[model samples]
Target: MLRDSVTAASADRAARGRAARKRVPRSAHGTWIPAADRPDPVGLLQAQGRDRLPELLPVRYARMAASPLAFLRGGAAVMAADLAAQPHTGLTVQLCGDAHLLNFGLYAAPERPLLFDLNDFDETFPGPFEWDVKRLAASVAVAARENGHKEEHVFGAARAAAGQYREAVRRLARQGELTVWYQHIDADLLLPLVRSGRRRRRTEATLTRARRRTSLQALGKLTETVGGRRRIIHDPPLLEPAGAMDTASLRKIFSDYRSTLPEERRLLLDRYRFVDAARKVVGVGSVGVRCFIVLLSGRDADDPLFLQIKQAGPSVLEEHLPSGPYVHPGRRVVAGQRLMQAAGDAFLGWTTGPEGRAFYWRQLHDMKASADVAGMSPGELRAYARLCGTALARAHARSGDRVAIAAYLGGADTFERAVGDFALRYTERNADDHAALGAAVVAGVVPAAPGV
Candidate 1:
């Protein structure tokens, strides 16, 4: 009976996909326009700032004003609004909701292999799969422009990425369900896939750096020995000690978080006791959100475990996209991440703060690193874009109807060409939005802590 039900559901989904293509033809995806009632981009950003740390909001604006690509990274909410206005097939998936190029990276799996997958899920939720693809393609185009690549190269990168995504989804759709669920692109497997010598070397270098970024390495870099006791060092606005009330609340929250973990993981966590914690600013888009690095110690001074407890607000897509079943924002992120990633952090869990804020916790630095796209040559950037697209396809296939999505994409280059054109157009829109933000900063309408 269960088997019949599952098969029936799959067939229904495939039918829906076919019907969606009829409703919104694949070629029509190239068109994009702001809605007549589209909200102001600056106004949307300011709305987000209301919930963030007041002091660090300037840093967020400055980061966004750095470049067009930088602006795109911080403008996920703005893009979500635009994407909501665009035509969609109504196929929902566990989107990395902010699926920019920089969000894909390398992290250590349980067996210690460096695996490449989506690393950030701050904006993750169930949304139209095409929104994620469009964001990725636009990011590629914007980043290419930032790197001074030719227009042809920019569009070529976007096209290649879209093609890779379409082809990958098709390939995964044909595989066994178990195989698709277990598939992961490890660094070793990824290196051979890079045809360019420069890209291969860059991949190797990134892997080397990722391997060295363990919890112990982070302990050395972020903490210090003061009067025979280990404590998180203060580094001005970027990293500083949490307030007494905040620390107390976090300790209580950690207790609640431990209950959500597996028994074995909880047991492993029992060996360590909370020692200290500090507020640490991180990432271009996450500067103002309350992020903390907590220190835990075992039996000896050398034994250490660092955990990051970050505030998880509503996903950027929550307002614009159809809502899911999640009530806790942190749980939404944790669930979406586990559903998308092949292997997730063993300690991934969520808790609610005393003030009703949702927060998620994970290892501070467990062998993680992102490729430096700015330094990549045009050829290398194109290759990297392809890998990101393939990774995104794999993630989407995990929770969405892969066969249906692949069928809508079809064997022709219609979807690829449309998305590529959309990417180029969106890049121009992003540049104008960025310039507006810069002018706002200059006019003193928006506070900015430039270069911080």
Candidate 2:
């Protein structure tokens, strides 16, 4: 009787949430107007560069200036500010914060099945759930445009993604909490959903490639024999040796990180001894950040482990949304990843770097593969967009009030079309922002290495 009463009260609250949010209406989310006090987009990019590694800022800008889609991927802060100014449902969730198309991927779970999910959580924090949906929908439009698709197709892709998200959320909301929590989309289950054609073949190939990306495979590709020892090969501007101090301080940092892991994981990690470390420039937005690849060896040179220690700064949403409870930004990322992902890296942990910067550690490229957006056909793009939407909804349902969100979306195309419209306009704005950044590069206002 008590359980029934509690369920009734919860349903009432969800119903109230739906009605309250409808006052703002889903269509209201379609508009985007720059505030008079809005920060200049290029200026915002420059502001972010201030605290990053000075030498690598040019590489970051060069990557962003390459294309409009690249610019969108790199400018999470710019988009965060824009989204914050737009109408929101006022429903908060732990967001990916940078949920662009490329961030969703295939990764192997500890149980060995390859699963598709959100693989990046750098900017994650509690924020308006629609912010992530907007970012994702906009990315689809931008990517479709970059692929030379017609404007109608671009908008169609965006609408399909939003529609999938709405439907997935509603479906998940009806399931029991344990069922929702344990749910995952594996490659076997996903491949059948795609029509049997070139798209299916492409996805199969990606899964095959991902399965080969184990620690052993990485050890062979990234290391070499040096003075009878296996050491990471240095490839400058992409991969290079961290200086002497890095070697000296890493022992302490590694110990501190091990302490953060659970006892079983700590015991598992104890077998490997740190061998060498390297500074690696990674991703569009993360190029200037302090990212390092640490090499560890177990019994022999053939048995190795690669851990990526990435610097964690404040979330892009931190300035616009309610502050999260975490004092350590690395812990914030780890916690968010654990809460959202069905399964996370076994070595996932956090520690302070030598210079007091908070950093999160995770296994580097453990059977991970991202979608080949550059090569996707119009049909494939639409299909991939829908998959991303479903994966995102699953992630959000794990943390957000799914019943309330499902109620707010209701059973209509209104929210989907509104999101599609927003995506179209934002893609145009992203192009303009890309042009502005490109001009800054040419004018030498922002230094850039064009081919890098």
Model 2, span 122-228: residue lDDT tens: 99999878889989999999999999998889999999889999999999988988999999998665576567588778778888899999889998888898998
* TM-score of model number 1: 0.96
Could you say which candidate leads in TM-score? 2
Candidate lDDT values, in order: 0.89, 0.89
Error of 2 at 105 (Å): 0.2
User: Over the stretch 1-452, how does candidate 1's per-residue lDDT look in tens digits?
Assistant: 99999788777766777788987888888888767998888888999999899999999999999999899999999999999887789888889999999999889887888899999999999888899999999999999999999999999999888999999998998888999999999767567656668778877887888999987888899889999888999998999999898898889888899988989999999999999999999998888999998999887767788899999999989888767879999999899989999899988999998679999999888899887889566777888889999999999999998989987888999998999999999999999899999999999989999878
Stretches of candidate 2 off by over 4 Å are 193-199
- Native-to-model Cα distance after best TM-score fit, residue 138 in candidate 2, in Å: 0.1
lDDT of 2 at 284: 96
